[model samples]
Target: MRTTLWALPVVLSIGLGTGSLAQQRSVTTVGSVMQLMDAMTIPASNAVFNVGRQPPETDEEWSALALSAVVLAESGNLLLIRDRARDEAAWTEASQAMVEAGAAALGAVEARDVDALLDAGDVVFGSCEACHATYLKRE
Candidate 1:
């Protein structure tokens, strides 16, 4: 009877602890990787892509450019989140590349430099393509 009582509490405690851990694991609010790319990355990057070809003329337009760069940079970090990374090293490298490219774009936008913005766009596109080629399995 003593052992039974003692073991019951131990088992219950472990069960409760694991249950909490499982709940914590399920707390990923960000949708799947594809959803993030479609909803956030694509739209934000479009803003950056439009910069040189259709340069921002107003403060509002410039603000949008800056916002896009910020989104891109942050989204790169988002890709590095647990379970989202396809391969740790490759994924980290690609995500860091995106951050660098986004930073470059932000710098160009701040400077209002069309040439630099265009170059930044190219870098951003290249980084995205490389990452996609490695991980994205198109259906």
Candidate 2:
């Protein structure tokens, strides 16, 4: 019983993060966004890791699709705080690619087209690689 009680919120926070945890966690908006981004990455990593053997995404895969959308939304919101035109423009380009990647995934989930799914992967990769090139710098 105690285990169940403790587990409930943890389970919910997997898909929901703006409630009780927001207060006690000392988490800023930026932290919350980072958490959300982390959530998105898990499924994406799984999908890509299992690329060859996995079934194409489907409407039932809405969980992953939602994760991607949430990440992209946070990215768009970050644009509001960009300190320079170049930064804003770079983020804009990446955000667009993120959107295209997500939209393609959503469409592939509904349509079950492997080709479209592959294309979505490419767009996602392009945005990530491009942004990393400019901001992250290679190790």
Candidate 3:
């Protein structure tokens, strides 16, 4: 598949990022992260439809957002754990950027950050793409 589509995550224009989740943990945790990646599109789809419009302002929407963030974060954390040669800090920054990309996308639309909204579209995509590149390939 087109893994490159989500290769960037949320660049947030920062000095790259990574995650804090440690590797060599229980397999279940890693599996959970995989599951989260698998579920990533669920909330993102909802958010896409809701963005620039009346999002699911109810608890459901909030929950969806939170869920999305966790999945995104987990993948980033996984990346951090997987890539020994990969710079930890950069991965973490990238992971946060990925999270921020989604958040920024929503926030941009909420605050009408038209440019950010436009930029986030790709940023968020990169986040998903990047994670899939490493993890999905593993599976």
- Quick one: best TM-score, which candidate? 1
Candidate 2 C-alpha lDDT tens digits along 1-139 = 9999999878788646654343355433443434534655445534632444675456556456445545554453443342321454676687566666666665664566666666666666776676657765557
Best by lDDT: 1
| Native-to-model Cα distance after best TM-score fit, residue 134 in candidate 1, in Å | 1.1
**Candidate 1 overall lDDT versus native:** 0.85
Over 1-139, each residue of candidate 1 has an lDDT whose tens digit, in order, gives 9999889978779779786444356547559887989887899899998876689999999998899999998889788766777676777898889989999999999998889999999999988998988887889
- Measured with C-alpha atoms, the lDDT of residue 22 in candidate 3 is 38
* Clashing residue pairs in candidate 2 (N, C-alpha, C atoms within 3 angstroms): none
Give the Cα error of residue 104 in candidate 3, in Å: 1.1
Worst lDDT 10-window in candidate 1:
20-29
Pairs that collide in candidate 1 are none
Candidate 1, position 4, lDDT? 98
- Local accuracy of candidate 3 as per-residue lDDT tens digits, 1-139: 3665565454322323432223444433334544544566445534543444654456676565555544544444454445321454544566666766666665655554455655766777776666456535452
RMSD of 3: 12.4
Clashes of 2: 0
Question: Candidate 3 — worst ten consecutive residues by lDDT sum?
Answer: 12-21
Mind sharing the TM-score for model 2? Answer: 0.54
Question: Which residue ranges in model 1 land beyond 4 Å of their true spot?
Answer: 1-29
